[model samples]
Target: MNTNSTIRARRIADDIDALAGITEPDRPYTRRAFTPKFLEGRKWLEQAMRDAGAVTQIDAAGNLIGTIRGAHPDLGTIMLGSHSDTVPDGGRFDGIAGVIAALEVVRALRDQGTVLDHTLEVADFLAEEVSIFGVSCIGSRGMSGSRPPEWLQRVAGELTLEQAIADVGGHPLHSAERDDIKAFLELHIEQGPVLQNEKIDIGVVTAIAGITRIEIIVEGRADHAGTTPMGARKDALTTAAWIALGVEELAKALASGEAHFAATVGEFEMTPNAANVVPARVRMLIDARAERREDMERFVDELDNGVGAIAAKTGVAVSAPRMVSDNLPTPGDADLLDVLDGACQTAGASHRRMASGAGHDTAWMARITKAAMIFVPCVDGRSHAPDELATAEDIALGAAVLLDAVMALDTKLQEDI
Candidate 1:
């Protein structure tokens, strides 16, 4: 289970640094999908893939794929990748780290003069982050045949998503599901405190949490702030504040339990700009994720009852939480999870099994083929921000683990076939 001799930490650092440098000069580390800066990054990545001896092409789904043919092509493909797009001024390591690690795995295999039984493909998925078009996971969805036809008509500026795909070298009208992939792997920053706090080198993800967004609105009468008594005014803002605090308390209690759960009042708005006037309306959007559907059901039920009590105590009207969007949890492939765990042991990497609180392209790919991913700790467990950090050595270790996993999968998949 020795680490591959060809896996180079310096090379991983260089690739990360190079991608980090492609961001906007005014906004550091911002190579957002469907932008000029993003195209520049793609150009560099494509050239890098070619230099590493890959046959590179953009798929019909707008996914940039670099393939290395294997000794036995009939066994199908073992694909590795993640999205390359970033959130606004988001950290360089979020999605970029995974794509680079996959590319490095391909390079390491080539350097060792080893060809496996399954063809290898490295993908830089398009628009995994919410794009200018207000949609996400475009490439992954398209590749998996889950993208609705209406999505192609989704508009940004004067161009439809269909045109955007064409601009990126994809034929959206012809995008189809890939059945040739025998397995899929990805590596991403942990974006949480568990791994770093536990001092673990790798996290074998058990599943991706289901995401739910709930909306609530509180309504009350506006009155003169100075003239109205403190107790007499029916303030919507205060009622909403109470509900938010209640959410925190409930979420804390749930998180302390066995399964992973988190809820955040990520978006909020208050009406009535006058300082002297009482607030009339307040809307809150809660982002909640749960590993178990039952947990999410419990949360919603408790929230509904809590809001009812608050409405009775106060003179304001609080609407029941309404579902904005809900995505079911996706469990990682059990066999692939075993493969990744074995790879960790083989690479001598310390690791533990965990669930991903954030979504990834792996979830979509899971629908088409056996798929799983690993997480490397990021400093402070922070992501979607400019200050996110992960050490070169840590990422390099993850790359080595991925290389081992790919090698293992090369044979393990053939047995299944």
Candidate 2:
């Protein structure tokens, strides 16, 4: 990395470290979308963007867009950004780190008075977590023209995504789409220990996983635990438990060398939830994932087959109330990958090319723009919890690489356009 780049990145990293109190519990920020805490963070970020000399706007989807104008007005803009709203009790470094790092990039650019030919933007996407709307990529999906109107309106009550956007001064359904913006780049923590475990400082994410969510209900006769004979009673909870383990094993068996497949039963509900009564019905939420679309399909098939078998054997009825599937596997842009790889080498950071098991907003935005992501290591594959962490040195190293990549693109747009 250039001497100037190193100096600039260190300064940026210091500023973010100082903003540590933005969220509590020190490690996980706990700033859910549309909450008062998120509002405060958004206000501070807006001021930061303005102070960096970027023209800022809140889009209809409640996405905060900060732009630095270029000499050429007609060239589409280059977006450097990520979401700030996090999962409940999520790590401070997960999404906030990226937003602040991009802010610092623009800060460095403006402070140095460097002018590029294409406009640059930093976005703080809203409602990335399934809060108030049960939708994951609300901001990016809405901006990309992928969010259905019915889904937005028919999905909920007062906490509709439309209302959330309106609360933030955005009219997504009525606003005209911006014709500019050529590509997008996002910097984020890896959220997994692979890079750290492998002693790599950076990861050029190859693809985002495709996720399938299923809500299963198992129904059996509720009876008095004291009087019902074990052989005569049908236990819904027991049947559901059997299906969950069976699905887990099936996923492991079907996982190929090239495909990463996983099945998890994250939530379980037993009617009455009492120790004395036999559960009449049990509800389970299954989350299955894969990096390949075909692999994900197979996983879902196996899940249904296993659940059916369990129901038949246990004399219980199984049904699915809802199945919501979104986010396809998004491969990173090849040109962006080359630029990022070169940046990592120039910055003298060790990097590995890998596919992300978790989803991010870029997975949705890639459908509309050329997009790729940069990842730094998480200490122990811990995230969405208070214990998630990354060292300052690693954060600084990742930021330096991000600065190099953005600078390269900023200059490349000048010559290409």
Q: Give lDDT: candidate 2, residue 284.
A: 86
Off by over 4 Å in 2: 1-10, 17-20, 23-28, 111-113, 151-160, 320-322, 411-417
- Give the per-residue lDDT of model 2 (tens digit) for 6-118: 33556655656544456645435677777777777788788888988989998887899898888775777888878777676764777777787788778767767777777
Q: Write the per-residue lDDT of candidate 1 for residues 297-416, one digit (tens) a residue.
A: 999999999999998888899998999999998999999999989989989999999999999999999999999999999998999988989988888889888998998888788777
Say which candidate scores most in lDDT. Answer: 1
Q: Give the clash total for candidate 2.
A: 1
User: Which ranges in model 1 have alpha carbons more than 4 Å from their true place?
Assistant: 1-4
* Candidate 2 TM-score, true structure as reference: 0.90
- For candidate 2, the 10 contiguous residues with the lowest summed lDDT are 18-27
Best by TM-score: 1
Residue pair clashes in candidate 2: 77-181
Residue pairs whose backbone atoms clash in candidate 1? none
What is candidate 1's CA lDDT for residue 278?
96
CA-lDDT, candidates in order: 0.91, 0.78
